[model samples]
Target chain A: MADLIALDDARDERLRDYTDLRDVQLRTTVEQERGIYIAEGEKVIHRAVAAGHTPKSLLLAPRWLDNLSDVLEATDAPAYVLTEKAIEQVTGFHVHRGALAAMQRPQEREPREVLAAARRVLVAEDLVDHTNIGAIMRNAAALGFDAVLLSPRCADPLYRRSIKVAMGAVFSLPWARLDDWYGAPALLRELGFTTYAMTLADDAVSLEDVEPAERAAVIVGSEGPGLTEHWQREADHRVIIPMAAGIDSLNVAASTAIACWHFSRR
Target chain B: MADLIALDDARDERLRDYTDLRDVQLRTTVEQERGIYIAEGEKVIHRAVAAGHTPKSLLLAPRWLDNLSDVLEATDAPAYVLTEKAIEQVTGFHVHRGALAAMQRPQEREPREVLAAARRVLVAEDLVDHTNIGAIMRNAAALGFDAVLLSPRCADPLYRRSIKVAMGAVFSLPWARLDDWYGAPALLRELGFTTYAMTLADDAVSLEDVEPAERAAVIVGSEGPGLTEHWQREADHRVIIPMAAGIDSLNVAASTAIACWHFSRR
Candidate 1:
């Protein structure tokens, strides 16, 4: 049975997992050190559990405790019940969703292991925005992309903002950080994948013209400064979305979705 | 010639156009009542001017004064130069972009007029996020969509964040609101548009299977609720972006981009 503990004091040390929710820097560091991530709202918390992530603890408002009884019954983790005011005091923000779960990070998978049976993949390079990362994951999962390989500098998809924006799609998508950001292109090539760098260059083939290989990987760049020339040159093919004159490009996340749509057309 | 004025006081009443920018409700009311919208940063401000918007006034940091001299020389609007700190104090946020312009909101065009000659259009229904609206605009512009038609409850594309996120694509792309959000389908039909509501209905045709019309409009819905039943039923065709077994739909912005890319191929 799960331990249902009453949380009367917001300052309790046990509530540290939910404190300073708005402090990105503090939360990121603490989460990384503790090897855990925050899953906010009832739906997202449910998704995290479905993804097989073990919950260290769950912070729930009184009203939410019964609503998530099934979820609580499935886990042995302690559930901390707090008043709305106490949750606000602990999280440093209003608990609008009425529930939050701090989940233990699942073990990392090697890129090769993730790509072993995959056909369509998205490789994100140096993307700094968590929302964009989450959106890409959502699009990738929706459009049948098998896995996401992120450059070392990409934002954490497990972050609360990303999980919220993705509507829990991050939990369903398979993703891993690339150990060698610089060698990403060569590594994909060696793994029997044809890499297409999504870019805007004169010589790039239109998205409609490029053929997806049996095993294909589309490499997406950061929000700004696009893909560095090195990675662009490394890919076997460069494809452009063929925009109208004058307008430069689609938002990175939008581009990811369109690219996935094109690649999955087969 | 634009008049150059020095502004040291952040609390000056004349600087009201640029105050407390983080307060969306307050800013929306003020901008709407003043019959103007803000264009932030050098790039978006330049885009607004290039789109032939009339600038009511320009608030520029001293460092940005020279950078935008060509723009200033082109208008008779007063340019108020403030220190970075004063700009921050006035805007309640760091003016990292360093400039803001209060530009007259362009006169609203009728939906019929915007769609009259357009071969490709994106009809946004009840989209509430400014960033999504902006991204849709950018995608529409980049992918050669001719215009955008928004439902009544859709967010204002002229909002600063939308302008910023769209990278000022809203200035270039033609858009108008459908005063009758519920009657949008009938109006589009009367205007000779073959409407497609992007949905995930089991019987919906795959995007690849649906042929484009001579004049096509793809209708996307809100982030929360997809297209309402009434709008979906009213659409000429309901199309699905075929996905993997268990996955659902893409983000509305992502759906917009993919849909536009599909329509533009014709």
Candidate 2:
């Protein structure tokens, strides 16, 4: 059984991971420095454990103890109980989700490990929004894409918000960041992926016209700026989802989902 | 040209239309009571005016005046100029998009009018999230769906956030709320629509199996709770997107987009 400890103060040293939860800048830095990410709510906590994430500890109100006893028992991590108010003070937000788990950040996988044996893959470039990244992961998993490859600047799939927004898809989909951002298309090409850049270039062919291949990489970019000029020019094919006139684009994540679905169907 | 009026006080009565912009509940009540809705930023404002909506007035920073001179010149409604800080104080937000507009809410169209000749239609039920509602509208417009029909409880498509998220697709897509929620299925049926309720019912057919009809209504529900049981049973057909095993569902808007894309193809 895991240790069940009582915590009284919000500033307790043992609860260092739970402080200032809403300060994005501070939380991002501290989470990185400590190599930890949080899983919010009961469902996400369940997903975290099921994904083989090692929970460093858990913080919840005493009332939630029985409901989550099994989660606590699955790991040797301690469960720290506090009054709801104290938990709120520590987190700087209401603990409406019942519980939170601080888990060890999984080591980054090599791009090859993620892409090996994949038939269809999503290549994301510098997607800055955590929600968009998470939604894209969920779409990738739902559509049965084999792998995900991210440019070095892409949002962290395991960021707390990303994981939550993805409904824990970050845990299920195999993803890795490219160490060589400049040579991503070349790397995918060498790995036998027919790289298709999703863009609005004038000469781009309709998404329906692109032939899905034995190994395919559907490359997408940030919402506003879109794929950098260098990457767009590097792709094997330029593809556009034929849209109704007068609209420039769909939300990045939505477009990615549609493209993935089309490629999977083909 | 719009009456060029400069206003310095955040508390001025003339700016009431733009006050407390971030308070959803208050804005919802006041907007409904006054028969008005706010359009945020230059693009949305332009779309609103272009949709034949009459502007009551506009609030913008002095710096944005020249950028929107043509838009202001197109309407006789007064334009109020305030310092960015004053605008922020009035709206409780930075007004970072350069302006906000108070426009007369277009009268709800008859469901028949929206469905008149639309071969593809989207029906939204109690979608409480404005962003989801807006995205659904964008998808409908982009996928070439003829119109949208909303449940009585749906978030307003013209809500500031919804307008912003839809990128003004709300103005282009004709939509109406069902006055008779309990009998909406019957109403659609009476109008010769082959109504398909998108649900997770165990016996539901795969979305691909449903035959696209000359007149179709693909109905979706709220983000979290989804369609009520009664409505689910009332539809002529129950359909589901074929998701990979172990996933619950996609975001409502994403699913709607895919479904629209499918129906349009057929």
Clashing pairs for model 1 are none
TM-score of each: 0.95, 0.94
Best by DockQ: 1
Q: Model 1 off-target regions past 4 Å?
A: none
- For the candidates in turn, chain A alone yields TM-scores of 0.98, 0.97
Q: Please tell me what DockQ candidate 1 reaches.
A: 0.81
What would the DockQ be for model 2?
0.65
Number of the top TM-score candidate: 1
Candidate 1 CAPRI assessment class: high
* Per-residue C-alpha lDDT of model 1 across residues A15-86, encoded as one tens digit per residue: 989999999989888999999999999988888888889999999998998878988999899999999999
Worst 10 residues of 1 chain B by lDDT: B243-252
Clashes of 2: 0
